[model samples]
Target: MTLSTEGIEPISNAVPKVWHIETVLIMETCPMVLAGIRHLLAQPYFQIKHWLEVSMVVDIPHIIKRHEADLVIMELSGEGESILDGLKIINQYLANWPSASLIVCTALTDDRLLKQLVAMGFMAFISSRIRYRP
Candidate 1:
C-alpha cells in the first residue's frame, strides 16, 4: 500500500531568517597598532561587517553607539590623570551599552590597574609589549 502526500511546510519557510554581522570599533593612539589590527581584522575569516578606528578614547561612546559595534578594542595607556580619565570614559561607555564587549590592549602591566579595568567591565586584557622567549 502507498500513502498519499498531504500539505506540509518546511521550518525554514515558516520562520523568517535573520542575520547579524559583527562590527568592530578600534580606539588606539598608536598608528602601528591600528594598522596591525586593521590588517588582521580585514581578513575574510574574521567576517567583520564594519571597522571603525579612532585615536581619541573620548570618542569611544559616540562611535560605538553610532555604528552599533559588536566589539570595542581599546588601547589604554597614559599617566595617572590620563589613566583615570580613560577609566571614567570606559565606565560611562559600559553603563550606556551594557551589551557591548570591550577589550583593552595596553602596555601597562600594573596588577592594580588590570583589576580595576576588569571591575569596570572589560571583557579581556591584552598586553601590547611582547616578551621575547628565546
Candidate 2:
C-alpha cells in the first residue's frame, strides 16, 4: 500500500508578506496614553480605524463591537483602593471578552498589584512613564 501526498506545496522563505487586517481598540481613561498609543501604532503595519479613551462603561460594548478589535489596550492610573477598583472593572470586562488581547499600562507597578494583575490575565503589563511608549 502506498500513500500519496500530491497536494502539498512548500511555503516561500522570502518572508511571506503579512497584511495586517485586524483592528485594535484602544480604551484608556487618560487622554495622554490614548494619544501616545495612537501615535505609536500609526505605522504601516497597523491600522487603527477607531480609538477611544473611555470615561464611562456605556460606551465600551459599542466601541468593542464597532471596531472589531483584536487587541484592547487599557491604561489605568492612580493607586490604593482606586487602582484595585479599576482592576476589578478591567478584570470584569476582560472576562467578558476573552478573545481580545488586553495590554495594561499602569502608573503603579508595585509587586503586589503586578502579581495580582498577572493572575488576572493581562497579556502585557507596562509601567506608566511619560517616556514609556509601547
Candidate 3:
C-alpha cells in the first residue's frame, strides 16, 4: 500500500517564534554607566555574558574569544592615551572576531573621531548622554 496524503501545514505558521537572545559583553569604567547599560539590556532579547572594566582593556580580545559574544559595548571616553588604547582594542577585537558587532558609547563629539571609528568597523556609536523615556 502507498500513502498519498499531502495537506500538512508548517509548524512555524502554527506557533510564534521567539526572538533569538543575543549575548553581549560590556567594557565600561563608570559604575553609573554600567548600571544604566544593565538596565537597558534587561529585556529578554539581550543576554549580558560578561563585564569588563576600563583597566581590563587589554584582555578584551581574550574575553571575546572565550565567550563568543554576539555584541560588545565599549565606552570610549577620555583623551590622549586612553583614546588611543580604545582604538587599538577595537582593531584587535575586529582582527580576531570580524563577525562580532562593536558599539562605542562615548561623550566625544568630534566628527573626525566618529569617521575614524566607522572606518575601523564599529557597528554603532551612541552618545552617553542619550536618555530613553521608554
Query: Pick by TM-score: which candidate is best?
Result: 1
Clashes per model (N, Cα, C within 3 A): 0, 0, 0
Would you list the C-alpha lDDT of every candidate in the order shown? Answer: 0.76, 0.65, 0.73
Cα lDDT tens digits, model 3, 1-134, are 97654687777667544434447777776677778887877766554554444435665667766667777788763323477778998988888888778889887788999899999988899777655698
**lDDT tens digits by residue: candidate 2, 1-72:** 987857755464344444353666555666777667777777665655654556543445667766556776
Error (Å) of candidate 3 at residue 69 is 1.7
How good is model 2 by TM-score?
0.64
**Which ten-residue region of model 1 has the weakest summed lDDT?**
76-85
Off by over 4 Å in 2: 1-22, 29-31, 56-68, 77-81, 131-134
Model 1: lDDT of residue 27:
82
- Candidate number with the higher TM-score (1 or 2): 1
Q: In model 2, state the lDDT of residue 69.
A: 67
* Per-residue lDDT of model 1, residues 3-72, tens digit only: 6546767676675454344788888776777777788776655676777877777777778767878888
Best by lDDT: 1
Task: Flag the better candidate by lDDT, 2 or 3.
Answer: 3
Candidate 3: residue pairs that collide: none
